[model samples]
Target chain A: MQLRLETKQLNYSIDGFDILKGISINVEDKKMVGIIGPNGSGKTTLLKHIYRALPSEYKKVFIDGRDIENYTHKQSARKLTVVRQENSSDFDFTVEKMVLLGRAPYRRSFESYTKEDMQFADDALNAIGMEAYRYRSFNTLSGGEKQRVLIARSLAQQADIFVLDEPTNHLDVHYQWSIMALIRRLNTTVLGVYHNLNLAAQFCDELYVLCSGHVVASGTPKEVLTPKLMAEVFGVEADIMQLKNGRLQLVINEAMTAQ
Target chain B: MIKNRVATPNGYGDIDKSNISSVKKHRYIASFILLPFLYVLSVFLACAFGSSTVPIEKVILVLKQELFGIVSEIITPSDIYIVWNLRFPRALLALAAGGGLAVAGAAMQSVTKNVMADPYVLGISSGALAFVSIGFMIGGVMLNTKWFLPLMAFGGALFALLMVFAVGGFSNTSSPARLVLSGLAVSITLNAVGQYGIYNAKNISSSNAVVSWMMGSLGGSRWADVWIPILSSLLGTAFFLLNARSFDLMTLGDETAISLGVNTRHLKRLAFIVVAMMCGVSVASCGIIGLVGFMVPHIVRFITGTEHRRVFPLSFLVGGIFLVCMDILARIILAPNELPIGILTALCGGPYFVWLLRKNKGRG
Candidate 1:
């Protein structure tokens, strides 16, 4: 099955301050689309609308040609999953137990987990290489390990589209790549927000460059990660290159000269 | 750690029907025999081991007669009255109160996502005390009448809960920290009002009775005073049991609950009402028994590993048993003249809460 996500001129405001202003973008089927922006550029606010975390006013956000808001929260959860930036819980929970909670959207109230649900959870744990840490308290895990577990939880949700907000923020290099590699292998449509231009350029099939709550550029990674766009939005001079596999690579040349 | 790793089962490929059957059998055995057996034993020990002069044999005999109408000729009438009428109902009240408080604590912790949360954190008890004190101002000796104290106390608790909700929800949407802070502020204020009423009256009877009530007592409880708390605790505990899955999801916070097909807004409102009502009833009858609700849930979590299905129900049972025993201590510690059960609970609960907080402070 193919899934396409379209955001049509979305606008959002909080406490009379505009967070997302008339922004629009389309995510094609089976493509890894990266949203690159500096902090507070409204990338997260835009992503939140796609997951129905915030209400959008200007137009519609459609998933597979249907209005996302028309679907109930459960129906939307069944189709799309999210991996937000890590925020620890005040209450402690076991890793296995936390992962199993991902199956919640599929079950009914008062229904216990079935064999199939356990199997699905086990498979997810195995996929993330966190099987041995199943019984460990989730709070005891390192930042990188917690991020991987969160991804595993998303996998257990078994959704078609993934909207991740800075998923690699706290991870080590090895875990960062491993998580990206897993996401790539899923072969599903992924829309992710990232601050790491190199990682996004290397992994994303298409890229949306956001600046001050607007889509400044949208195209192939090589086209979007140019020195000009970098200087304009991020206030840095960056070199963009193509590798042997025709994939884009970005290297920050220098910080922009003052004045 | 090595043993733990090795203990984890690898693959289902080698599994057969027999292994699966054995696992199921072990589960059944655990649920049917081990847990319940342990629970019953805990309850009996809790019931029998008070600081009083009564022997276990006499207590058991009285209990038997009460439960099944099987009279033992050896036990005397005063002992029977002490065991069956006075101590038994009081113990049962402590049990119900303890269990109710613990479950309420667990529920409050879950909904608010606060590890230190308890039933009294909402200020229901303090509010109830304020109303009970009001009863004293009007009736002098009449406040000692059974119905007036509990009725006014419950009314006060309900009023406090409503006030807390209003304060928390006044400006922005209600958040846990805001709710808890508001509840604390309201509790302190209501308590001041109650104390002022007592100070103004300054009558020996009303003031001393209020002070004793604040200390928390389950002594002097008769069957007449038993039914309301019993029914309220039963209904409240049952309500929590039914929402076990929701409580589990809620501890993860609202965003997770919403994604899990729970209408968190609705679930939160429902939980608030249930917890408030339970705490209100408990405080009204027991006169501000402290610590059971806070300590028992945390202790249960340490043992059961924070799965609400096990933690919630087991907490109620364990809390009930603990309170009964504590009540027994309160009665017999000074003999004839009683200590308030609340004093012992606060003494126990206060330190335990500090220890838990210190232990987990940096870990989270």
Candidate 2:
């Protein structure tokens, strides 16, 4: 059952400053949508609202054609899981146990984990190539490893929809590609905030470019990533080239000059 | 697959099939059972050892005889008075205070995301002291009722927390560092207020009574006064355990917990109230015992690891035991004079606190 994500006239403000103003977006069934923006562009704020981290106004967000605000926190979590960036912790848990916490939404206040929950957690770890690290202390793992474990946790939630906020903030290049590829392979309805324009353009089926709290441009990567839009919105001068692999490759000359 | 091998910190080397409820849980189960028993033993030992040093067998026989309400004069009434009326109540009070303080500390550490947090870090104890000091200044019927002091202390705790929040300028973006700094500043300010209030009091009592109360004392603890600590600690510990998973998630920070379906704000409010009440009760009964609230959780985690499930229960038991044993030494060391419970806690907590800080020295 594929659900469409729709947002209409979403407005958010803090300290009399508008962070997002009358914003609207829609993600089609099971397609990956990436929201890319420069710093302070309200990309994280938009995603935060969708995931109920902040209070969203009534009827502003709709998932599966029903208002997202209508769902309780637990109900929404069961349908939509979040793979957050920078999940650092002071306390330590085993990797398996961290993944097992993803089952919390399915559990009642008094319920303990059953055999099926363990199986699901194990499978998630296996899917993310983190089964070997199941017994490792969560905080002791390297950044890339921690990110993978967090992804496994979200997967264990068994949600058809996932939202990620700056999903690859501190990852190295290889892990970045691998992590994005892992999400692509999952075939879930994904809404992600990305700082890396190239990665978003590469993996996302649809793209939304947020600039200064507004959707400056949005479409398929090929359609929205024109030279003018790049220069105007991103303050960058770039040559969009179609290489032998038929992938859109952005080559920049004097990229630093735009800033 | 039926789980077989166990995963210890040294890697999975245990081969017993029964030892396989995931390595950490199984090992912790042992400590959980063993530690509470250790606490009971220490309580009994504490009951037996004092200025007079009653025999353990006599103490046990008295306890058993009392359990059945059969007074066959097995132990003399004086010994019985020391063992049952005076010693047991004091020891039980210490256990409850320690257990409650430790659990509150564990919860506070997670809630504040600060390793420096104790049960009273939000100035609950100081707040209680301030209120009690104010009461001392007013004197008369205000201090006459049995429940009056604790209830005042509890109110003071909530007031102190509010002051902390007001001074801290609580916001979603404020780092844990900022919050802790704000709380400490408020605490220092309140401490001054407490001292000033006591110093200027026009009451017809010794000034030492107010000072000793501020420093923390379990002296003259009657069975009548033990329930506040017992009830609040039990509720706080139960709250922490029931929401233990949320506590673990909170260590990961607020945004992730919210996304994972935790009502972070609600849990935080609940934790704050519970910690405040626990600290208030402990302070009212025992006069602001500090070390159990601060170091017991850390010491327990050093051995049991930082998993909340293990940390909470173990800290509760060990904290109780540690304080009781320290109180035993307090009763015996000076001979006819007793040291304040707070002083004993600091004596032990100081070295361990230094070591923990030194171990984490390289990192800011």
Candidate 3:
């Protein structure tokens, strides 16, 4: 499989405090890769760099094997899209209009969205099972519904890769599974930050465990979700069980206290 | 359950798509057709019902004769002068100033991402007023030139905008609260300077003139005063309409806009410059018309949705109608002892502003 995204020795700091120190990761085409980390482990910071929200160094990050710096914002948007946690707005837009904005990178400064663009948006909404709420106000939607709408917007972008920053953060368990399932159905390269290890294990084809700005472990979920690594990196005691279906279930026992 | 259910044919479920589209079509008609017709009617009314009431027929005849070269035998010279020279230009100035200020306000709100932002609240008008007052104090060829006052006003407005951005920081990192606070500080300081300039004027007549102008009136408007405001308002509205989609994206927050291929910083800088230019010209034309900017956009948004493509043009026409109607009230309320147009706008807008603040307080 071809590498869809690669970040080599990505380092970021703010106000002289190092947030992401020399972190490297690779995601293959048409695979969902998960980054599991504790809070303040630079998950969001790394995602920011990947999405070009924070400027990354030349040759540090590449999409489709080309340096990310070579692409303009519009070109990069066509190649990769993002679904962020902070999707609320001060003003209201209809779900249709909000999803239509995904076509913005394809539009010129003065050009209106074409009929084809609307068709793409509609198809994307249909994919997320949100076509029924097309006319509803975005702010009026529930948390899970809004997240689904946001994911639908990313789908409308028709990008080859998606970078999601905790897209399921505030959703309920049902919504979390549903959203993860929806993403899994996309069949595009996805790099996501996940707090729930079990969900990561259930959905992700590969995993990178980050601790204090470093990739502490990288492998399939069965290889990375060991009890020793969970206790050492996440400061938690856990039991890993294999079900008859060959899925790994992570049962967190207790949090280890600081010595 | 998900597999068994069939999707609605239109895919909008229970929502009546036709009804929604018809409503949208009506809004477009109201914005494009009805509002403009009302604006024209208000201009005629403004021309007809002043301290000396010229008949509406005569008002129409005067406009026709002057504008289209169709000479009228029924019109007298004094009637022509009253309608054509005095009321027509004054009404036109009111329209231009009102529309310009309102559009500027809408752009300001979008750039700052705050509903409460306007040219008046952001100190742009105060800065222009201060510059004009200082020019009045100088009392030279600068004051006599056609473009001098407006030029000074533009410079002052640009300076104040830069100051606000400097203090508040232009990056998304700066909170909206910081922007509003910086605007308040700049407004207060510039207002004091304007007041001091007027208070220590070398002569009484100029001081009184500045004082009345500061209170905001359309009494002295003439053909010479008409073109700048109209041109600026029209051009500014056109520019904003062309970039309406970007403004829509701006309301979604900066980071999201950036991810969607908008160069938010560049867009913001351009928006601020246009806003400053528009506010400066409006303030220079009709000395400190407050709150028309703040109120008109919100009213337009209420009638239309929050989309700028709908909001910008409607704001221009509605703002024009609003001020023309207000000027009529200002002229007739005391019957020759005219109240300043600004006082009426303040009377209406001050309470609305308070209500908005209280409403937004809960959100914050």
How many residue pairs clash in all the candidates, one count each?
Answer: 1, 1, 0
Report residue B298 deviation for candidate 3 (angstroms). Answer: 1.9
Q: On residues B199-233, what C-alpha lDDT tens digit does candidate 1 reach at each position?
A: 76655554555577677877557877888788878
> What is the alpha-carbon lDDT of model 2 when measured against the actual structure?
0.79
Q: Candidate 2: how close is chain B to the reference, as a TM-score?
A: 0.89
Residue A9 local lDDT, model 1: 84
What lDDT tens digits, residue by residue, belong to model 1 across residues A1-259?
4558989888777798877777888888889999999888899888877886566453479888889868777788888888865566666676676788788778765578887778878889889888866766677677878888888888888887888878886778887787898889988899999887878887898899887788889998877777888898898888878889887777787998868
Instruction: Return the top candidate by TM-score.
Output: 2
In what order do the candidates fall by TM-score, top score first? 2, 3, 1
Instruction: Tell me the lDDT of model 3 at A49.
Output: 88
**lDDT-based ranking:** 3, 2, 1
Encode model 3's per-residue lDDT on B1-364: one tens digit a residue.
Answer: 1122233334335545423423554677767877878999999999999889999999999999999999999999999999999999999999998888888888887777777788887888899888877776775766777788888788778888987877863456666566667888998989898888778767546555567688888888999988988998999999999988888888877778778887777788888878878888888888888888899988887677677888898889889899999999999999978888889998998999889878777554
Q: For model 1, how many clashes?
A: 1
Selected candidate, larger DockQ, 1 vs 3:
3
Docking class of 1: acceptable
How accurately is candidate 1 docked according to DockQ?
A: 0.27
Give each model's whole-structure lDDT: 0.75, 0.79, 0.84
Instruction: After the best TM-score superposition of candidate 2, give how far the Cα of residue A159 lies from its true spot, in angstroms.
Output: 1.2
